[model samples]
Target: MEHDVPSLPEEIIVKILLRLPTKSLLKFRCVSKSWLFLISSYDFAKAHLKNSNDDRLMFGSKGFSMDLYTWSPQSAADHSAFGGTIYPPLDQNLLVQRVCIDCPLYEPHDVVWFEGSCNGLICLSSSDESLSLWNPTIGKAKKLPNSGTVLDFDYYGIGYGFGYDELIDDYKMVESLSFEPFAGAPTLDIQLKVYSLRANSWKTLLNWPGGHAFGGSGKFLNGAIYWSVHRLDGPIEWVIVSHDLSTYTFSVVHLPHLHNEDNDDVNVDVKVLRGCLEICCERNTHMDIW
Candidate 1:
């Protein structure tokens, strides 16, 4: 006689599933049609990300073509057999799992740019200025249509910010473009536009100051994406630029005072730590945090 496994309640099943890593959850989605539906649901995706124990650091490159690396902290902490991994905690080491994904490019010479990550979805921007939303876990990707701001890449340059808006249960893509001065124009113009996943449309927003956005990727915190930007005009100084996801407006945050005013060229970066924004400034000999 065959013994049957006990049926699990839906609530209990959800609790168990929320704790699983994305890699495993993707596989479990094939168990049944019901499971596939549940795992693919938006509510489940948010819950799983909120309750997940597997924190990972992802690294990608435009030069590396379709390849990426993710380092899992939970797996490192769980493995105690490796004595050499004891120095700075296994979570600190780069024990990476390499991943490769197929991305549709707008241009042959277009390079890949990992724009940002919110919950489990990643925003990808190509050199040709196309955008895509990707979920590495489920292996699902959606390409966003051109916002129609600049047709032939004639704009000076384009930058992006990605985050989620909880009030409306939506994810947003904030596109910032700095335009080169027209022949008669006095100063450079910066245009702003927002793409809403729910609306599946792009809406033009108010213009922001024209300046170069601190590169790499912006950090998303408290429903906004923050950028360390260098102002184009006035005295050379650094300012924090933030776009609120809910209000769809931009605001500037002040950085901590620097004792060495003469050394304004200090390297600065923003990071989220302990549920708050931390501005890190690196001096010649030491680093300061605020």
Candidate 2:
């Protein structure tokens, strides 16, 4: 006797499917044609990004390679937070998914750097002046048009950043570079350029007023991107310079007062934690987060 199994209601099916882990959802797309369409839709992507609590960590190297580790947090475990990082127990096993990053636009040997990621989209750049926006979940990539000269991060104090502008619904990139000394130039010469996905071009912005930006990744939070900067005029002071994504204006964030005035050699690192800005100071063997 062949008993026909009752089909689940479309609404009920969507409700259950949207809450599943990302790996299972990705695999279940092959269950049927409708499933595939629902899983691949832009609306579904946005819902999954917001609803799904699939904690994932992406680790990449210079090669066109990346490994993703996904694990659920322990419900009853205690966590210690520091420098924008949460310390969880390391005993539990994690599922590692290896995803191959292919770039037909640039050579695989080119040194790769992770510019930034926003709304599940990742942006990467290499030494060859190539910029690409990649979605690891969908296994797809789009090479962005060359903005201008190659903004190499290898040089000290040169950094690149990527983010999304919600007001315009556009993805943007910022390149902060250290320029060579010229006649009549200040103690430090830095140039900034911003790229808009909708405009499809880069526009030169005013010079950074933080004196000099330390070589590091831009920490994007709230509505701005921040970098560790140090002023060389007067006494050496480390501060954070932020560029507002919406207004395109520059502002300075004062670092926490050092307990020891003599400890001027402390290193400053800017980071975003739980939707807030934080700075990690390291002096000798002591470290503090502010």
Q: After best superposition, candidate 2 residue 269: deviation in angstroms?
A: 1.3
If scored against the real structure, what TM-score would every candidate get? 0.76, 0.75
Q: What lDDT score goes with residue 225 in model 1?
A: 79
Candidate 1: the clashing residue pairs are none
Quantify all predictions' global Cα lDDT against the true fold: 0.72, 0.70
For residues 162-262, could you state the per-residue lDDT of candidate 1 as single tens digits?
Answer: 88998999999988776655654434566778899999999998646434545324678899977776655554466788878898777887665554856
lDDT of 2 at 150: 55
Question: Model 1 lDDT vs. the true structure?
Answer: 0.72
**How do the residues 99-170 of candidate 2 rate in per-residue lDDT, one tens digit apiece?**
455545446565666777777777887766678888766567888887676534334356777887878777
